[model samples]
Target: MSNNFKGGRGRRKERGPRTNDQIRIPECRLMSDEEQYGVVSIDKAREIAEELGVDLIEIAPTAKPPVVKLMDYGKFKYEQQKKAAEAKKKQAKVQLKEIQLRPNIEAHDLETKLKKAYKFLENGDKVKFVMQFRGREMAYKDMGKEKFESILAGVCEEASAAIESPIKMMGNRIITIVAPVKKK
Candidate 1:
């Protein structure tokens, strides 16, 4: 989380408005007296907008029936900004954190690894669990697989299951990736 809302002096310049992503709201239409058809006259629409002390913003121009609004453009813009801010607040930025282990790890060491994994998962981060295999240890891959299985069970609630399972290799390492669950 960053101090993006910390507006004050000595701030960096923004890249102008992002109107390209604006969500267009519904607006009222105005037409002249002679061309009003089934709609209210332009004078009446203008008077309504003026009474509300808001802009008579023309929203649609190239339609068979053009649209307009008797609303404060500034207020509409502010509401749009508030909605965008609320959406941004709900999004999480997941970071990748790696933990290394060995097949011959002791119970205490495994506990430490599990604790670290839990911390990373609770902090909106993805965890990469790696179990290294030495020369002769490759023959005992079942131990590494068991270790991976146990650890996955330990943090299953904290993290969602990754698409692929751990990849084991000859005299190398067993690697698995897990993504954190969204915080309630």
Candidate 2:
């Protein structure tokens, strides 16, 4: 196989749209919020932009005549960045935090780990409870299942959380996921 097929690292950075004097096209389709001046010469577009104290930005370079817009490029760029940041901020990230335990866990130790799980649930994060068993301990899978169920119930009692995934035995370990309930 070719090296390029395996995620090549030589990709060039994408260039943004041309603005103002960078637009060398003889004519372009000019558009604005107030009005659109069909296909006009570059000089005419520049003249209009100069009169409005704005920039002539080439929006769709691939279109016939290359669609251009007359607007304050600085303000347009700022608004685009602000919108991107707001979208990023509104993105939901569901993180899964894990708590590991053995089938023969003590009561005090179970309480401590349960507190940690509750804290994770309260913070709107998913909690994965994993109980691992060794060779002989594998015989007591029921005890591990019962312990995990009880712990999940206790942690979800105060905080409104739901089981995201059901308990399943994976080799020597059993795992389950619990996520905080969504508020309307």
Candidate 3:
């Protein structure tokens, strides 16, 4: 029988700042909200942290003598997690919505597609108009390009959108991207 485990006790790898005995440096600049204790032996910093009933947290380990602070480790971790959650909540997520069209699509059908694109832009999403060409339709690429340009103009004017990517031909398709204009 062979033991494949390589490490002791299978403890989870810790993240963020090193606290208390985990800080192995000989000396560090100790600080707290009230005062700075300059550069002191690591043992001395630990003692002061004990006196203040706080943990000696190594915040900046790459500095000259390293930097440690006296604080409640649990509270510090909680605040950091809160800040991250708040930032994620405030971030804007934009989705890409594709609308397919054809070179010789009926006027009514084109209008319907444009309406869907307008709704997507109003909802803070990007619109990709893909005009597909098949067989003999490939010969009419110029007409497809013209239709894309006209669609782009109409969308920009009616939906407060801007062209993110100009119309371009890609193999058998003409593609263009439009995005909603940012408010304020």
Best by lDDT: 3
Q: Estimate each model's TM-score.
A: 0.58, 0.77, 0.86
The full ranking of all candidates by lDDT, starting with the best, is 3, 2, 1
> How do the residues 1-184 of candidate 1 rate in per-residue lDDT, one tens digit apiece?
7776767796656532212113133333553223432355556666665665666555564554456555566776787789999999998787879999888889998888888888887776788888888888888889788877777766775455442455545348778788765546
lDDT of 2 at 113: 85
lDDT of each: 0.66, 0.88, 0.91
Better model by lDDT: candidate 2 vs candidate 3: 3
Model 2: per-residue Cα lDDT over 1-184, one tens digit each: 5755545587545466789988999999999989989999999999999999999988999999899999999888888899999999999887899999999999999878888888888878999989999989999999888987887787777678988888898999989898999888
User: Between candidates 1 and 3, which one is better according to TM-score?
Assistant: 3
Q: Write the per-residue lDDT of candidate 3 for residues 64-168, one digit (tens) a residue.
A: 989999999999899899999999999999999999999899999989998899999999999998989999998888877887788789889999999898788
- C-alpha displacement of 18 in model 1, angstroms? 13
**Collision count of model 3:** 0
Worst 10 residues of 3 by lDDT: 4-13
